[model samples]
Target: MNASLFCMAIFSVTLNAVAQIALRKTMLTLGALPSSLITAFSFLTNLIGNFWFLGGMLCYAVSIGAWMIVLSKAEVSAAYPLLSIGYLITAAIGYFFLGEHVNTTRLIGIGIICIGIVVISRSA
Candidate 1:
């Protein structure tokens, strides 16, 4: 891949990771969901004061733009698999920031995803 293309891919992936974290943080603040639409909207309108969700939406917009740039230069098949990088990042963010635990089996799964990315990159 060209240097610019590689950077775009990485940026896209990283932005996606950040977005996931932000959304998670936002949902945490929002607490439990309401059953009715009116109640849900009321809660959301109130809870939307949370900065994290807004930030996540902004990050998602940036990520989509970057992803479009990447797709313009590369095959979708190649670029799409790159999204897995976001999962790896989200896993780390969840573990560290959210105090979530990853068991040995999940670690193995993450390792597999890492290996897959490496292989895909090499082949690309």
Candidate 2:
């Protein structure tokens, strides 16, 4: 990928990661949804009004726009794997900002993902 495309891919993945984090936080706040129809409708209303949920949706929209641009210029075989970078980004953010655990096994999985990303990028 060219510099601009590479940057766009990074931007897309970062936004995607942010979206995941935001949505996770929103869910943590909202807890489980009600099973009853009326209560479920109320829950849906509350979710739509949530700032974090709206922000997450906006991030996803922007990320998809940037991702579309990247796909136009890059091969899917090479470009799609770049989304895996979002896992690393999300895991770090979760550990640092959200007090989420990052255990040894998860760290090893993240390392493997990093290696895969490097290999895929080089292949492109």
Best by lDDT: 2
Candidate 1 lDDT over residue span 4-112, tens digit each: 8988999999999999999888878887789889898888885667799889999999999999999999988888988998878888989999998878898899889
Work out the TM-score per prediction: 0.91, 0.96
Q: Please identify model 2 stretches exceeding 4 Å from their true place.
A: none
lDDT of each: 0.89, 0.95
Give candidate 1's total backbone clashes.
0
Instruction: State residue 71's C-alpha deviation in candidate 1, in Å.
Output: 0.6
How good is model 2 by TM-score? 0.96
Model 1 CA deviation exceeding 4 Å by range: none
Candidate 2: count of backbone clashes, pairs at least 3 residues apart or interchain = 0
